[model samples]
Target: MTDLLRLDHVTKLFPVGGFFSRRSMKAVDDVNFALSADKPEIFAIVGESGSGKSTLAKMMLGNEVPSSGQLSFDGTDVAAIRGRAAREAFMAKVQPVFQNPFEAFNPLTKLDEYLFATAHRFLGASNRGAREAAADAALQRVGLSLSEVRGRYSHELSGGQLQRIAVARALIPNPKLIVADEPVSMVDASLRMSIVNLFRELRDELKVSIIYITHDLATAYYISDRVIIMQKGKVIESGDARTVLEHPTQPYSIALKGAVLPPDPAAASAIIRQRQVVAG
Candidate 1:
């Protein structure tokens, strides 16, 4: 199976402070990964704050350029994709589900607008009827209906609903790859599973590869096939999901696995002892 997307030694840096005394902040440090088109799987990027997971995502989306290295989609250089047509072509194949569902849509506008816009703009659906049909079809894919979501404000919908709608909008273009950044973090506990499960369905049913960026290890463990642990703009640990989480080789990975809050005190105690052993 050929790779759909590839990141080769990618790095991104930002300048800070005064002009003369400017300091460079390395957001992404020589990270590398590949997603196979034939293998539709959830690839998890797990990391704490300031770990460059988000930066790497932005670079992947072509929202930010890499300071060094390359990002290619289907063998074409992502950095070279410029202008409206080129970007639209790239966007049709790769879409994003932002961290906050509330912010992803406009508060003042109707939720359906984003979906309809994506249909018209990306899917080339002409006229109101065609656009509406495409929008409704997308909604159905995310376990939602147009009637339920049409003309609704961002505040009116629950976190889970909003996230699902966001997912639906991203699906409007029938993207091959979806970059979701901490998608379910803001949703209520009960709703978190629903959204997480949807990602599994998207991979299995829709054949879409997802780049799931999250700090939550429990859900990551549940949904992911392959996982990468990042720390301070570098990949410290990565491998098959369960194996890496069960027996982490890196201290950062162990710490992250330790930080997961268990449901019961007994389970918590067991995890603590395990963490102690791993730390030793």
Candidate 2:
């Protein structure tokens, strides 16, 4: 299978302190991973805050440039794509679903405008009718339609619905890879699984490779095909989701696994009761 993305000895550093201090912070250091173009899979990046998870996502999305090494998508260097034409071409194949759905879109503009705009921009639909059709079709893929979403303000929709619209906008580009950085963190718990399950559907049915980044292990274990655990900007454990989570090899991975709360209320309650007893 051809590799969709390849990171060769990639590193990103940000200067810190005054000019005289001579110190810098390394966000991502020599990190490497590859996604297959031929085989669509949910490849997850798991880490706590400040682990450079979001930075890695940003680099993959072409929002941030790496300090060293190569980041190639479909054999093209991301850093070299400078012109408007090249950047647009790269954006067509790689899209992003940001962390907060509310913040992703404009409050004043109708949500459907973003969808139609994406279709017009990326799909080359010049006229309003063609753009509308393309927008409706993309929304349909996410179980929403133009009728439901059109002319609606951002506040009118729930977090889950807003996120679905964001995904739909990303799809308008017919992207092969989506870098989702904590896509469901602000969403309600009841709706969280629905969105997570949607990512699985996008991989299996739509054949889109996903770079799913999150701090939640339960959701990661549930949706991901492959998983990489990151700690302080370094990969601690990497393997198939079932194998790694069930039998974690690294100390940090073990600790992360131990921290996961069981879904069953009885088990959770039992643990809570034990904690209460200890506190007394």
RMSD of each: 2.6, 2.0
lDDT of 2: 0.91
Query: How much is 50 displaced in model 1, in angstroms?
Result: 0.2
| Candidate 2 residue-wise lDDT, 103-188, digit = tens | 99889999989988898789899999999999999888888999999899999999999999999999999999999999999999
Task: Show the lowest summed lDDT stretch of 10 residues, model 1.
Answer: 252-261
Off by over 4 Å in 2: 269-280
Clashing residue pairs, candidate 1?
A: none
What does candidate 1's lDDT look like per residue over 189-262, in tens digits? Answer: 98999999999999999999999999999889999999999999999998899999999999878878877979
User: What's each prediction's TM-score?
Assistant: 0.94, 0.95
